[model samples]
Target: MPLDEPAALAEGSSRLPTLEFALTGSTADYLIHASPDLLSKARAFEHWESTRLAHGLLPFARSLQTPPAAHTTLREQDGRDVRGLNFSSQDYLALSSHPAVVAAAQEAMARFGVHSAGSSVLAGNVGDGVALEQALADFLGLPHVLLFPTGWAAGFGVIKGLVRPDDHVVMDVLAHNCLQTGARAATRHVHLHRHLDVDHARRLLTRIRRNDPHNGIMLITEGCFSMDADSPDLAALQALAQEFQALLVVDVAHDLGAMGPNGQGQIGLQGLHGQIDVVIGAFSKSFASNGGFVAGRSRALKEYLRYFAATATFSNALSPLQIAVIHQSLKIVRSVEGEWRREQLMQAVQALRQALTQEGLTVWGQASPIVPVLLGDERRARLAVREMGQRHLLANLVEFPAVPRHRARLRMQVMSSHTAEDAQQAAATVAAALAASAQLMPQAAQTP
Candidate 1:
């Protein structure tokens, strides 16, 4: 459906307060209800979403009419096409459209047909799939690797497969949802430490070890946080995990194959490449495919996860086409060409950061593909999202429940293919959109 431009709601309508509730409230507020009926509980939340959708204030579930690239077209809810400089896709190295990657996918399609047709443990382990696993193992310098259908499955699987109910999980407070969910599923002794604070993590580990000395402890963090665009001190985290007799797992979904020298991501950048206990990564970000993998030094652990991880054992294995594309993408990611792409990507990142800073926008995190422009208030963020659509600047709006309340931001994903001009244009468009959004705030408050 086409999204109509947001119009002012009439004063004193019931929907006016609902709209206010929608703008100020968050997803967490509606997650629990006293009502026993499961379906009826979501009515209030659905009403809020519908109100936003009608006014074109909802900036999610957008349809891409074309392939994700440096520039692409998107279909609005109302069926109108909007072309823009794309910064919303996680194609960090911009290998999604590489000629060799596409060729490999096409070749595999002809040879292996379409589907894997079975789980990896059953009959889905095709030649290409086997080769891809080995290739990933080699890339990460880990002898053992297991593949999952998607990154989320891999992340969740690793924790759920290994950690028994008696085990304890100590995770970064800002860790990915899959990791957090996995921790909750595996055990109830979940301790979340401060974001990127190794000392806090160490204290948590010490406390857990003191209370539960016999149970296994798993310390989880990310190589690069997707929302905050930041990373933890891998070396310090590893050392702490070792000191507390715990296992450390680093999720490199956003950084692997896209950053660091030789594409080793934060682990390599921090000189802790092969020393990490467990490394989890996703292929969708930089590998131009849809899959995830867990790499470790222990072959026994890999085999155990293969059979025990519900996602890997139950879900269909990645198709041959995906395996081929990732294989070729891996080759590029490990080559000299990959180094060049990383440099170009960093340059683009710098350019975008500089431009956004020049435009007086508060850009968060370090120099990485994700550049978060802080918008703070949910009301302003909703208005800015609508303005961004009108300005033809494609970026993602992240609000409460994802980040802290009143700290919404536009998470822009930069690619190697994004030029200096693209960065400038994106920054300019964002500045204007935020300005336009700010102008309507007083009016918005009065309407409710």
Candidate 2:
């Protein structure tokens, strides 16, 4: 999402000398008013601007805006998409356009209405929402569940409700921004274990368990990492939690309906059903609806209901139509457990990874669904993404802070709707982009 993110290495290190490059002037009158450090920074950035101008690397994101004005599809872009495939978007399971899901939502809308006139605290909590929450709790094997308007809000509500400043929160290293935001908003002692490093996590939990066992100590992790698409070892982490006497809260945003024995997620997959203290996920992803939820035991749920600050509480509830669609989707996803949707999805990921790997693009992730092409330099990442569009492939770029600097990548998501041929075609488009980007920016790949 970062635009004009400077990649010094991508920009060519030897291309500019520090002292000379750092000596340019701005409106600040470098003749007498500037500190040496400030003058140097200005010059470096000024040199950066000059290099950008020379390479035509400057970008203006005219595509950004509220909906109505936005371009509807990559398909509509000129000289693009005669038949290139999409490697981006979180339409995992691809239930949005499913006929069954569509029909159920229509029926619910007929029975209930487009909008729930008030908040849940008022009269917005519809009958279908009640039933859906019950259905969710049953699937999760939890005693209670609460729905929220969005995954980010649900996460924020959970942490803000449970984690006091005195609390200690530990999470998997690569948790999404939602978890980090929620944790930081709730407490200060936020400790992150290396991605999937439960043993290292256990070491930190040991002290909290013994000395301040009852103090608020929460362990947060994702059921499936969105970017890398790898799953956490829930059974292992659950064991560590019991040993350390800490509460384990997991976000199944990516795993729900795609993981576990019956698509119930890692908690169910590992037989750690009642052991996990809390489970959270977005209804938006799996159900292809517009909300999120938190599930837990009665005690926790009741406490959360009292303290959780979900934006859904103030906003209109999921339209009865959306609730029905979600319920129907969940049921179908469960019933179709042995079907090719899941297998095909895995196959597609493997195929794309293999295809792109052969083409010399650095792809990361296991086959849980997300694929990130590690284009180490930011501008190369940008050029790769732009050329991907030229090849009619729709993918997104990830640059610094969403990832570390120089770890910029194109995060590709796999959807069940994508055919084997679709994935392969997508890979070809990305490969083409890779080759073109390499040729176009030879210096970028040459830097270490």
Candidate 3:
């Protein structure tokens, strides 16, 4: 499977654009890339036999080089129109298509046309974006919020804005990719702590403090990690940040509508609102909208708006319609309808976790809605997904360098829209697929 060293395509050492179509029918696309560094790219091609597999890229959905269709779902290789499943989506409350949200988008189109009409600086600061920001900040127990077009942009901006060249950022080994990419511009005193090992994080902070006492240290993590689906102990993080005098910034992309007392996200639910220095999250997940934001005390947010964020200044602001819909979505996320939906998701997660455990499957997530079914080997993991397609459930396939080399998995996330029935069905199919592939996969067929 080793591909060419990346120079085979389009020359100049950049890996050529290689594509792995859905041999299994999911959006589990694999792109080929030339090495990012030209010298390394040339050396890589020289050393390796420019094959098809060695130059593999990360997962498909993450590239975001292009916008996904409004309601696009991929057809499976099995000829099954399995895209209708309630699993594998970030739409916790299914608010993306809520009548109110759709109507708001329509209204926005009427008022502002399809685009922002103009950039934020030129378009005269739309009221809807402002309103959504305020609403999100209030909900998360922060004083202010600044919207961005993507969560990746927001994550990078948080570190990029706060950390100076000499400052340090110590993060969980498993922190979101956004954090790493952003922190690259600064000193990445990265502590690949044992995932969720709060004690390890504490120890790392203590070491970093002793080593560089005056350097600004920002602790970054996800409120509820998208891949792990496990909630970080915010209480522990709050104490750690305080003890180290490090600013704590949490990205709550996965936890926004699917967590907290009433979907105020983990910050509001944890009651550490004021204690935690910053909160960042996406409007796409849970809220079923598109865009991202950072929240903090009003003063800090004002600073971020004024100078901290580059995306806010240069990128086109989020659509007024996204803002309005997300606002309405958040308002109702924990209301009567949202509560019922949340309960259903909880039941599904519990059922799936139990079923997975009983099948001796190694499900990584603890209680949150995300469940990672580990399967190691990349091509094998992809094949397992092909099997899932046969059963009509789309399981996300993730592979190395995104994760460690042998940590490939089928990352499953739950939606509030899912029913107990959906989880059970997916689990059953997963179990069947595992059994079938047990002989084919030797890395670790059984997990608990």
Reference-based TM-score, model 2: 0.80
- How well does candidate 1 match the true structure in TM-score terms? 0.94
- Model 1: residues >4 Å from true position, as ranges? 1-22, 443-448
lDDT string for model 1 (270-373, tens) is 98868999999899999999999999999998999999999999999999999998999999999999999999999999999999999999999999889999
Write one digit per residue (lDDT tens) for candidate 3, span 1-448.
2333232543455554433321111211223335566565444433332232223222233221112222225543222244434355666666666787678778887887766754455563588777777777667667777777788778887778778878878777788888887887756555566777889888888888888888888888778877766777888987888899988888888877876677766776678755678878787777767788887876756565545567666678777777677777877785888777677767767887887877777888776777888876555565566566556666577776677666778787776656666776778888787666555543433331
How far residue 441's Cα lies from its native spot in candidate 1, in Å, is 1.2
Runs in model 3 lying further than 4 Å from the true structure: 4-73, 76-86, 118-124, 439-448
For candidate 1, the clash count comes to 5
Candidate 2: pairs in clash: none
TM-score, one value per model: 0.94, 0.80, 0.81
Best by TM-score: 1
List the candidate numbers ranked by TM-score, top first: 1, 3, 2
Q: Which predicted model would earn the best lDDT?
A: 1
- Looking at model 3, report the run of 10 residues with the lowest lDDT sum: 21-30
lDDT-wise, the better of 1 and 2 is: 1
Ordered from best to worst lDDT, the candidate numbers read 1, 2, 3
